[model samples]
Target: MTLPDGGQSPDALRSGTGGGSWDGERSGRGLSEREPFDLLVTGGRVIDPASGRDEIAAVGIRAGSIAYVGPVPDRAAAYSRRTIDATGQVVAPGFIDLHSHAQTISGGRLQALDGVTTALELEGGALPVADHYRYAEDQGRVINFGMSASWSSARMCVLDQAPAVRPQDDPRFRLPLAMFDQFQNGPRWQSAADDAQESKIVGLVERQIAAGAIGIGVLQGYAPGSRLSEQHLLGRLAEQVGQPLFVHARSMAPAGPGNAVDAAHELIDTAELTGAHVHLCHLNSTSGRRADRVTTDWATAQRSGLRLTAEAYPFHAGSTVIGAAFLDPEVLARDGISTRSVIYLATGERVADADRLLELRETDPGALCILETFDLDDPQQLALLLTAVTFGDAAIASDAMPLTYTGPAPRSGTDHSERALAALTGDVWPLPDGLIAHLRTSGCFARALRWLVRDLGVLDLVEVIRRCTILPATILAAAAPAMQRKGRLSVGADADLTIFDPDRVQPAGDYTRLAPSIGFSHVIVAGTPVVDGGDLVPDAFPGRAIRGSAG
Candidate 1:
């Protein structure tokens, strides 16, 4: 519930057992009740993709779920409630970000401001699942989130004891066997890997699932052949538990042998062997046929009745740690790629000379690099591919990184993070185009959807909304038992509708290679307006964590 000033209380909350909350709900000890729904949004084209309803409608919200959805209710006469005019607007279920590196679902607020109602965290899922639930409840969040287990994430916690964890080698992956092998055997503490490593890995993942992770996320790209057995085991366990696998298969760039096809099929093989659901992360990152092959394989498996799905972001270049092999001509040429095709991102120094890259790779393997591989194309073609691949089953993944917000603000002048500092002694830099094309400059959801509906002409309003809403809601519900009231535009669905001027809703994505970070206007979450017009309302963290199956 919302506090008087349109925020959640800082006090601890606890929900009782059976149909219990993902996190506990606090006793409304001292505060007066909120006005049920803060406002009523009416006169808009309401599109609930989950159920496929597209028409002019009115939505009533109370305690965060749609109190009514169809005919407009009296506003001035209906007690004390605010009224929102939605003429010429598009009212649809809020979006969902299927993949991200979130430690806790509470981090979903970043997405809510962008109209994302759900954020699913990947890797290592929710170790100590209780804490993840608490973070969401404590925030009185506007959006919802789900957990995914990461083999790499689990290893860092139960095994190493850190708040954060990534793959052994640069998990974001740049390819090359020498670099890839580290994830498999792991650089010994010389030899015997404590013998308990495998057990710990399994136990950690199992616990994350038990805690609340709905699925597994393997950045197979970085782990290479490292955790194959464990991943196979994870797949087995996920199947038994009915959780999907969110895999960042091998490599996305045209690098080495690890394009989307290679990594995805391998995971598919594991799915075949273990009997589980497998999802490919960021399908469009590769170019031309390689990207097509991934969707083809995914389709074949699904049609054959092997549960499989994939996710793709709207951006062209991907962001990973900045020290990957995209800089090495040897690696590039192998993929039929080149340096000119790669631009450095999240760093300040220019890329190193070929000789320097070899020197660095040999000397230091942990170096980071966020490369923007230039796979430039007609926006129309890009949208078409996304449409062809989604299969109406695919979900949208913002791939919106934490550093994008927590990283020094764009106006900070100079990068202050340690990673940025480290890359400086060497030549690394934030790609020029990234700061623009990524929608970092503005809100991103509309542009992402526009690519799907308008440019690609793949889907109309209904199907796209379904991908963002009911589809993700179903996924979240699979994780948290309390989320039955989420994702759809039903009477009981969470009142998380976004209302925007349809004509004015044209994409604001400034995707010219030089200006990626631009977006759109009007974002509402959980019956609350986190972004009015186009400004982020600070102190508005209304996100909730969604736990997974206990069975």
Candidate 2:
């Protein structure tokens, strides 16, 4: 092992830093230099928010790890043997959507089309994250993907029923039994439900973590019965695992018992108390506080740094299942919400198939309230979007309207397919199909991004790209580790990249239910192009499940 002339022998040099780390598990030891690279993405804008670099750069890929990132100096330099001409296009890391239900429910191929490289399924919106992650990995997903252990889904899966009150607080757990007659009167359900709630849920979270869930998703609105203690428990578990907690506030209903502002404050305080990295989901809703009010509350909370962040869709309207729309109007009086603030996203005027709507209300109430007005006027949306274009890592999401369910062949007797489909997805407010279709199309994200580069003129292209790339990656890492490597286009970064002609690039927003946003040119994932020249390239899934190393 001794050096001959001051330097080690060639064999030693080659053996020391070139082996034993290909799998990347070395107890804090870094990777060596000789692993076979999987792919390389070269010649792109490389808007790396992490390194504060936004210029022409090349990324080297080896063994599925980024081996180098920086100006290539020369394409002939001693860097990557492989390269991609991302010149005149964006080479920043892939886009990450934090709470996208569409990610798994839509088969994820759709999200890949939208240039979303990493999709984090959260709360109750998607299937159990572990199962979905496994499916993705088996397919060798072309886009990076992760999941959060959904609190609502977790509890529901455990209890196999929803509660009416915050049951965790009561020592007896009797309050829910008294409040929800169904839980009380059901057939031998209470005891079984209780056991399922306590033991199965804990086991489920652990299993998801073992299966590579990045963090936990907490959607309180979806689990109205989840008490403060239940949320605290979820936070504690996530904190123990060093994962992020995605929170969709419980009472952000336009007609709810608490103002949206109050909900925001509540989340901030909960985060402060629980010591969890709290990501507030969907900043605007009819039940959300007024835009001006939310601005003040969010500013103050963010300044305090309760590890808080929020996401917003670019459109003027918000969408959800109709059952949420039918949340007791009396709650408006309790929460001091103004009914005028709410506008139906899907439901409008006459109820679609009155009988169907009634049945949906009783059994599967959350059919479709597709879109509605809540917070942030069009002007405010423009301001936020404009600001984000320049400042990277704002954590923006498409929040595209996605179908929740594709049920079995409709009964031959069914007339309105949309209504029947809506029932399957939990839509109760069945409105006209033509009435609220805009919120579901690509025009939403395009229009939002457009207001920035064109009308507002707030940010240059570099800054806008950074926000979408690096900034979001950083924010997501604050909550989930999978997003950390995803937002960069440098050496050792993932090969997920997007290249589009700036001049020719345009948002193709056509509100057709049949096909939406089907055009994206050259979507490269993991150093492979999935979409070329605005068309899908088959047999091109290069994605994989990203594991969280923090825990």
Candidate 3:
């Protein structure tokens, strides 16, 4: 829709028309020799959503930023150390995930394979901001990473309850099974904050923001008992710091107090009252068939100067901890779903009734379950809801859950001993079949590209790229300065790019089998190739911390 200024237009960029000539002198080239470049990507259909550029071009990188983007120079081969021939591929800015929960190494690697270069946990951020960043850095992330200050985690921390996970709590920096379980069946999920507890929660939030959180992650849905006043206070704190408030709204029920519409209004009203920028996570899952109505409300809020945005994944069924209170029979009835619709990620079996749900909750409190809340079985209804969110300009996010290993460990003296040793020491192992049971963790972005752009044709290629790149970047840049130079293909922008075969790019996995997508030929993060020729580059850790202004 709105093209970014000072960037090439789609036609000009694609067709190489009506732009400056190849100015070698201006690009630091001498008469006899071209300036050396660290990497050169040649002969690709460069689609820069920010500039509306979609032309064949060559890109040059120096250090970790784009140094040149234009016609390939005659001496380019001689001046560059690495060259990737990108013919027949679409070279675009790497996708930026706004609400990813894939913070672990296995998760990050999966995201890289999906063409993501920057993945942030904004929906439910980490408790200790410093530790979240430090752990990712110390453990060697495969993509740029960051997080917001989690109001939910802060509330649990102040209550002195053991959270499902804590930032850097483990020596190996692993996501604890405790974190996912705590939100479902504990006091943290059931209790409402009083005056003293509310004040302490607010204090923790402020401290986290001061420690470099990009914004405040408010997951009120997990704790329905949390008072609106407590949320309002969190909004005020975010507003005071000029940071956005990323929220997973209170409920997904179709009727009653905690319905999706009421949940949206809660955040909209809070943002209006506190002047805080608020982003709703996973609107498709939360609002279901009523997503269009919710989008209308968000648009109305924006008209009134309430800064509101929302995101959605491509899938219809949404996953969460099995023991979440919202899964209670009364709530599920209000939401119009049943236990029969509940699919357990660990077993891939649909819970047959209340008895089965209770059995799973009692036996496996930490297991993740998928609720078939939307019209996933109907193609037309699915397309309509998907189109509604994209029509509203909602950004795409995976809400990717972390992949965990529960199988037997590798033997000490086997041929796979090295792999076993790494797994033992690194707190990670090959993802079990159950871990990749859902496509959301590994195929969300690619699925969005396939379903929205290639299949339904709801959006053109450039528009989809904009939503995944510049749109999310623009939203975060208001609070996180580190994002300003990202999500674009202009000179001086970070050399994070995803080169894929647009014709072949599609999600490969489904509810039955989990697999990574194909066609992502190259994924570059900060000038280093993390995924080369459709395979992950072993031991590559070019990702850096994306801190906020507070840091």
Q: Highest TM-score: which candidate?
A: 3
User: Between the candidate structures 1 and 2, which one is better when assessed by TM-score?
Assistant: 1
Highest lDDT: give the candidate number. Answer: 3
**How big is the positional error of residue 488 in model 2, measured in Å on the Cα after superposition?**
0.7
Candidate 3, residue 522: the lDDT equals: 96
Per-residue lDDT tens digits for candidate 3, residues 1-551, read 12343233444423434222234313433322355778889889999877767888888887898867877666667868888999999999999999877776777788888999999988878766777677678878889989888787677676647443544665433542234445445555456978888998899888888989889888788778889999899888888889888888888776766678888899999998998889898888877766767778888988887888878887878888787777876678777788888888766788888888888887777677788876757886676577555857688889887653333455556435444334422534443343443578788888878888898787888888888898888888768876877898866678999999988988887776667788899999999999999998867889888877765
Tens digit per residue, CA lDDT, model 2, 2-32: 2321222335433544222322321212322
**What TM-score against the true fold does each predicted structure earn?**
0.74, 0.70, 0.90
**C-alpha local distance difference test of each model:** 0.54, 0.51, 0.76
Query: Which residue ranges in model 1 land beyond 4 Å of their true spot?
Result: 1-38, 74-80, 102-110, 123-142, 156-196, 251-259, 286-288, 324-330, 346-352, 356-370, 378-392, 404-444, 506-522
- Tens-place lDDT per residue, model 1, 387-454, is 43464477666665432222453444454554443321122233222222234212345655566577
Q: Give stretches of model 2 more than 4 Å off.
A: 1-44, 57-84, 105-107, 125-129, 161-207, 253-257, 286-289, 325-360, 363-369, 374-393, 404-448, 458-460, 478-481, 510-520
Please report, as a residue range, the 10-residue window in candidate 2 with the lowest summed lDDT: 173-182
Backbone clashes per model, in order? 50, 29, 7
